[model samples]
Target: MAVLIGLAAALAGPGGTAHAAVPDSPAVTYTNPVAEQRADPHIFKHTDGYYYFTATVPEYDRIVLRRATTIQGLSTAPETTIWTKHAAGVMGAHIWAPEIHFIDGKWYVYFAAGSTSDVWAIRMYVLEGTGANPLTATWTEKGQIRTTWESFSLDATTFVVNGVRYLAWAQRNPSEDNNTSVFIAKLANPWTISGTPAELSRPTLSWETVGYKVNEGPALIQHGGKVFLTYSASATDANYCLGMLTASATADLTNPASWTKSQSPVFRSSAATSQYGPGHNSFTTSEDGRSDILVYHDRGYKDITGDPLNDPNRRTRVQKVYWKADGTPDFGIPVADGVTPKRFSSYNFADRFVRHWEYRARIEANVSPLADSQFRVVTGLAGGGTVSLESANLPGYYLRHKNFEVWLEKNDGTTAFASDASFHQRAGLADAAGVSYESVNYPGRYLRHYDYLLYVQTPGTATDRADATFHAQ
Candidate 1:
């Protein structure tokens, strides 16, 4: 596992030509495990300027929620228990995987629960909130959804496409071998399934059938003309991973033939990152609303004594999601713990991203093996709105300027080192949507790559500005 160290470092000395003092404006950043023992995480940013969060508590007894103005604020936000399980009837035991959503000016919570007599007989249920704020709203219990069979069902999520609302979930078909499969159906309303359910995907892949044949926790996100449904598979242990299903945005969502499943898992456990059994993920935009962030839960340690559920270390974590050239989402490896970072892809050359080769900054093809290119955008050494880039693969080393050249080096604490490491992060001087790194010491000079080598240069034309522009992941 990669050790997470502090971002604070000593300022460089005189004539060192690299490090500078830490910035005055605190860096806008957040760490992983926003909350502890919170699994099956879900976060949504509403128009009211708050990011609401809910997840499966380790006890699995009730639904709790929290909201904050910023993503980082959720860590300390007070939790509110909006609803509790029934004492003996249907919604009585094993309350799990609660997701809160606002629909038609009201709030609805879709969750899985089981009867007290039959604790394992889990099924989906809903709670309608009547007030404006979900935390203070009155929740009315909606009964279990009747599916094709009274079998095991859970993980209900809703989304709208074009003008139609649909519900997607996981269920055990009577004819199948006790394996959970993913299903989708058009919604009559927020809590009811209007039509027959269509089985979108089954646990047929080898990875999906690992400890147990499973496919659950369906999350939907639409882009362009494609509907992306991501789900968790296998047992809820180290074997747990994420799989994806895709369908056309205009396709009949109730038709089983319309959806296509991936042969392998899209996201999974990473021993190097100290995150095991990483699954049941949700998606939301960044605080800036310009990037898509993946929210999920995972065990911090690999080894567990008894059942993985009892371990209770499945902490909620978040990371930025990137995109491929073909427009498909690229959820890289589960990152190592600490502050997750981003990659800067050149605007002029979209395929090339800024990376380090032998401690020297360079532009390389942005491909599958992405760790080398990822860097943490930390507070710059020089104060006044400047920022520094710290390498993801090589911790403690940062991108610093020396002799008008960008170099990845270990901060040795010197005035020159501090001055060279600081750069003002700004909107792309060329492309408004893109970004540019202007040197704090050199003033108008910006970080740009020529012949794949990074250097500080003054831009005088559109092409020069384009060379200095980059799309940060």
Candidate 2:
């Protein structure tokens, strides 16, 4: 299951508009989920400015890792087989999605495996890295981790909160209702349990109880003074979805009741999207600190006619995650491949793309009554785009396309030569030698002006000016 091509990026112009536009961006969204060829995909950001993606490949008893300089790069990056199962026992059989975690002073890789007698006898194992650099160093098998006293346990994650370390995982609890459930406990070490586990919740919701009432693949995230626990729900089919638990940062995290579960699944396949079994997700931030991406695996079709176990369309996919007004995570509705994204700006002036600047427009408007420095013409944009202005002290926003001289027109139809203050001219068109106007930016270039990115500001003292110029750093 490969993802259909729909590429996008976020950029800023030297002129500081909140967002830079990317070309071929679909202004609207339509959901079209993907097929699954990968299972339980995990993403990690490495120190070398690359992201490494790993997932379960049931056919091959080996740990395969893919790396790329960018999140988009990982999807098409060259994959490397870092480790493989060699025997039929303890650490050699049924090697599942192995996750690499760098902690304390070493690298620890965790996974689930078992002996030849039974694949269901899956337990957790860890491998340690001994050299200074993991990519070029050797990883020594540190052996199976001592987990809970249960025979069934996998999909484990280690996280720290409020200075205390903890581990969460899914397991088969005979003492509980259906035997399969989710739980968490404090870790004695990287592999040992320190205290009694708490039953977070049962697979009762419609999303979680989709097939045989299974809940697994728990991942943790922290944001906006709250900690979020996200889990995979249902069987590995179209019925698969994502369920979440949220708790405030000040709450007693050890208590399962302190966490509140979402009434519905956070992520699931809709009819618009032909893909199914969309679960087992991880979250990572972008290099620019402006994006939070959702990493998950999807299957292209709906019905698993034959055997679901042998189905091979589970491939990995990723998309940007948005946030709600309250600062909580909002996994925006997923869209189909090839859907155009909103244009984004990439005006990083340090790279010398263009000189752009933004500021309040100092208006001497006699045609209409307006305050001084109440208008702005954010310039240095290349093609067709939009420019906005507002009363800094008032709560209103104004927007118009850049192709026309909206700012200049609104400011009593005047264009002043920026290079010289000697002449004040009338504005008729933007492309004229002394006449300047904003235009939409192409995909590759960003609006750049000034020593820093420009944005509109409020009216100031009578002498304050609403103009900016670009200067090389």
Candidate 3:
């Protein structure tokens, strides 16, 4: 969501204090690649007020954990190798996808490992920690988790619904044609699954069969009285994406009939944003517990030499999650590289977003080259208490007004350009939670979309006010 400041009555000149309901503070911003070379990332925020993070290290030699007070801080948080791989035998090689969770007043880590003699002999394992802090806690190996006919398995995650705990994961069933499929079962405890495991999804769609017929990395989140389960599809290349299954909160989660799969992938690689093979995501909330964040791994560039798994450039990234009116999430596109850009959706036209096409500014839905719709709200070029909207794709170009029409133009480093490009951000004319931008040079004129085109005008009607408002997220 937009980092918005409440509108106050007071107005100020350049270099003066900006008016807002709260005191002025710098916007919380972060760049992509929250953690480098960390794939299959998972983040768990605990009650003690720290976000615990873990992922697959490229070397596959050990399980590491880190904690930070904020999501962005996870980038630099010193990671501790809680458990190293065995010298031989079980849990010796191919260690992957470690997820840390707080359960029943203790910490549990669910991960997959293979033996040195047979690197692909993957199976799920559990590690228990009894102390308040997992980093310092003495961990005990719980050995391999027994699943129903686990030919090959990994990416185990556990969640609670009502009072019953459940374990969800991806495992290869010898009877199935697909390489792997997602399964869910009621958990007898953190390390054991009870009853028969129900297969929630299999790789049957064309998108799921790219390079490999796979459905792995299952992550779950519940909202709007529904439980959403997302899993990775395809091979670990640019074709990797996310597919989801939905079930009612009250449904019998273990019964395969209770779940419905989405026909299309929920999130995927974005050529425009330069994020390749985006999948294996875990959800967490913002520091203030106000917004949901998607944490996953992707390579910055598309082309990789040899096998994608051996490339070792998959970096963990995070982006804000926006919800539709129907209470479902719109992952949108993987954002452009710098400053975690946001797309401004028109308040009245929820489907339409403020975007630039051929340097012309307008509001359009399903914008081609989606990056054109994203903008970074940076400090104003005029250096006053104002802001400037910089195009995400075109780094140096900004949205500026000329003859009342908005256009994306390059910063020519002139006073006229700065004045035209800068705007005084105010509370949304239609909704205080949203935002409205008033032109710096043209007082009383605000940025509004009319006839699908962007303009600086004095909105006089309710519809006009709504059109003037935009949600930047």
- Full-model lDDT for every candidate: 0.82, 0.55, 0.86
Best by TM-score: 3
Using Cα atoms with residue i matched to residue i, what is each candidate's TM-score against the true structure? Answer: 0.82, 0.66, 0.84
- Looking at model 3, the pairs that clash are none
CA shift of 61, model 2, Å = 0.9
Predicted structure with the largest lDDT when compared to the true one: 3
Kindly list the per-residue Cα lDDT of model 1 for residues 288-359, writing each as its tens digit. 776778889888787888987777788898887776667678777777677788788766565678998878
By summed lDDT, the worst window of 10 consecutive residues in model 3 runs over 17-26
Weakest 10 consecutive residues, lDDT, candidate 1? 17-26
Candidate 2 vs. true structure, TM-score = 0.66
- Where does candidate 2 stray beyond 4 Å? 1-36, 339-473
After superposition, which runs of candidate 3 have C-alpha atoms over 4 Å from their true positions? Answer: 1-29, 343-374, 379-386, 391-398, 407-419, 424-435, 440-444, 449-453, 458-473
Candidate 2 local lDDT, 1-473, one digit each (tens): 11111222233222322221221211122122222366778878767677767788857488777777776666567677767886666656777767766677776677888667777777878777765445555878777666556467778777888877787888888766663677888877776777788878678877788666877888888877899988888888888888899998788777888999998888887555354677788777665545666778877678887767678677777766544446567664343443212211221211121111132222121211111122222321221233333221121222222322122222222232121111112121211211212223222111212222232222131111112112110
* Rank list by TM-score: 3, 1, 2
Candidate 3 on 127-244: residue-level lDDT in tens?
9998999999999998888998858999999999877899999999999888999999998889988999999999999999999999999988888888899999999999999999
